[model samples]
Target: MKPGADRIELRGLKVRGYHGVFDFERRTGQDFVIDAVLELDLRPAAASDDVNDTVHYGELAERLAAVVSGEPVNLIETLAARLAEVCLADARVAAATVTVHKPQAPIPLEFADVAVVVRRTREESA
Candidate 1:
């Protein structure tokens, strides 16, 4: 984010997604945690005190959830990138950072979590 840029952040968004390379993983599914940070200028909303002037987080949550729960992708990187795209869809947003966490991964050893983070800008996607 740029200096003084405003942000809207969503954390620990859990969804059961059928995304994995293994057959058992795709069949049973696993919990995916998503964090999305959107950077934008909140000055207009602050001055006007209007919801329209800012991003609606409730709507954004639904959209993000849909992406996580809908189609199945093999890699969390792809998931993160897709989520960043959704975040950058708003014209007001300048940058978005998305992290996809797979807590229950099919790893042989004990681990806290596996995740992929992606950052995207409006200009980059364009």
Candidate 2:
């Protein structure tokens, strides 16, 4: 299997975090929704039917949640970048795309959500 030919996706990972440009946002905190797509070759796992041959998405989810809950950042862009880094931490993941959604952003008008998306590869991450 070639790299980037297969994908494992985790969507709608919601965690409360203190990340925003405003002081009140940081103090009060809000729900941050995360979505991640990890690109890699999954043939080995498919053939062997072993968890070790592929990324364990459940474990990855937990790790991502930890990141969202851990540090306080100023921008969803930074948060997205951090999540991409976490996704790429697994050597088997050739690339990762991370999206961070802020539903309660301090916008004056009505909006569904504000978000940032970032894509990173192992080489770029290095």
Question: Candidate 2 regions off by >4 Å?
Answer: none
lDDT scores in order: 0.91, 0.94
Worst 10 residues of 2 by lDDT: 1-10
Q: Please write out the lDDT profile of model 2 over residues 1-126, one tens digit for every residue.
A: 566689999999999999999999899999999999999989999999999999999999999999999899998999999999999999989999999999989999999888899999998988
Error of 1 at 22 (Å): 0.7
Q: Return the top candidate by TM-score.
A: 2
Say what the RMSD of model 2 is. 1.0
Q: lDDT score, residue 41, model 1? A: 92
Worst 10 residues of 1 by lDDT: 1-10
Q: Global lDDT for candidate 1? A: 0.91
Cα miss at 8, model 2 (Å)?
0.2
